[model samples]
Target: MSKGVKTITDAEFETEVLQAEEPVLVYFWASWCGPCQLMSPLVNLAANTYSDRLKVVKMEIDPNPLTVKQYQVEGVPAIRLIQGNNILASAEGVMGKEKLISFLDTHLN
Candidate 1:
């Protein structure tokens, strides 16, 4: 886990994400994915930047298959913005910092 980001597992998904008080930014990644590695920094930045309004969590796809399947996350570097039982927004692949910010602004605001 990086600064401002909490590592979450499949078993903790419900308690940590679905039950969160604020919107949660879920970053789905895997150890062997290059794009996942590339997006880590941007995700970390988002975690810090939106700490007050958002809960940032990282889920490794391998160990968290339950959540991955539940979310229909078919690829690495997937991003999902969820609040309560609703999924507000989602995307796949690596996104740059600016694009990431724009995406958050669109869904979060």
Candidate 2:
């Protein structure tokens, strides 16, 4: 199966996310972050569930410093919902599948 989860970088952030035709769910994470690691599977599940509705993109905080700083992501496992190049809502830390879905719903619809 294709891993719906993708690691986005600074260069691709604009075209791949900000300019996306559909809404975007971005998970800003770090490999060494405990919460981020724990939330990986949940993020993947959300990606699969919402694959048809929104784009689920993962950005490694360490690699995408520019975007990270630009977004002011101060914590790992920060989930940002973006549409039309604007951040509608965001939250940090681990999120279960249900809560994540609800959060997405609040922003997308």
Candidate 3:
């Protein structure tokens, strides 16, 4: 993990995301999306807060088209919570700190 968060790409998806031992939170984003940029710091903050319980991964939709397709991502700033290759919950658009925390609390613990 770099800077306390793991960034997953199409090449690393299967092992780092699908087979992760702990719950995985994939933040699908793109550089062009304003909301995505705004949400990044919150994502990083959540990564720091939930360091022990989850693996927070950022997947750039533009770079990882395959992952976007596989996950059926239709928008930037999409948050997908997964466990053992199964999706537990998902949310589209930017999420605030409290909502992000609530999302993680619901799925991770």
Best by lDDT: 1
**Least lDDT summed over 10 consecutive residues: which range in candidate 2?**
1-10
* Candidate 1 residue-wise lDDT, 1-109, digit = tens: 3349999999899999999999999999999999998999999899988887999999999988889999999998999999999999999998898899999999888
Show where candidate 1 strays beyond 4 Å: 1-3
Give the 10-residue window scoring lowest on summed lDDT in candidate 1.
1-10
Write down the lDDT of every candidate, Cα atoms only: 0.93, 0.85, 0.87
Instruction: Tell me how far the alpha carbon of residue 15 in candidate 1 is from the true structure, in angstroms, after superposition.
Output: 0.6
Cα lDDT tens digits, model 2, 1-109, are 4339887899999988989898888899988899888889988887887777888899999988998888889999898888876888999988787888789777767
Clash pairs detected, candidate 3: none
lDDT tens digits by residue: candidate 3, 11-95: 9999998888888889999888999989999998988888887888998898889989988999888989988869999999977
Cα RMSDs of all predictions? 2.1, 1.7, 1.7
Error of 1 at 50 (Å): 0.7
In candidate 1, which residue pairs get closer than 3 Å at backbone N, Cα or C atoms, i.e. clash? none
- Candidate 3 deviates by what RMSD? 1.7
Whichever of 1 and 2 has more TM-score, that candidate is: 1
TM-score of 3: 0.93
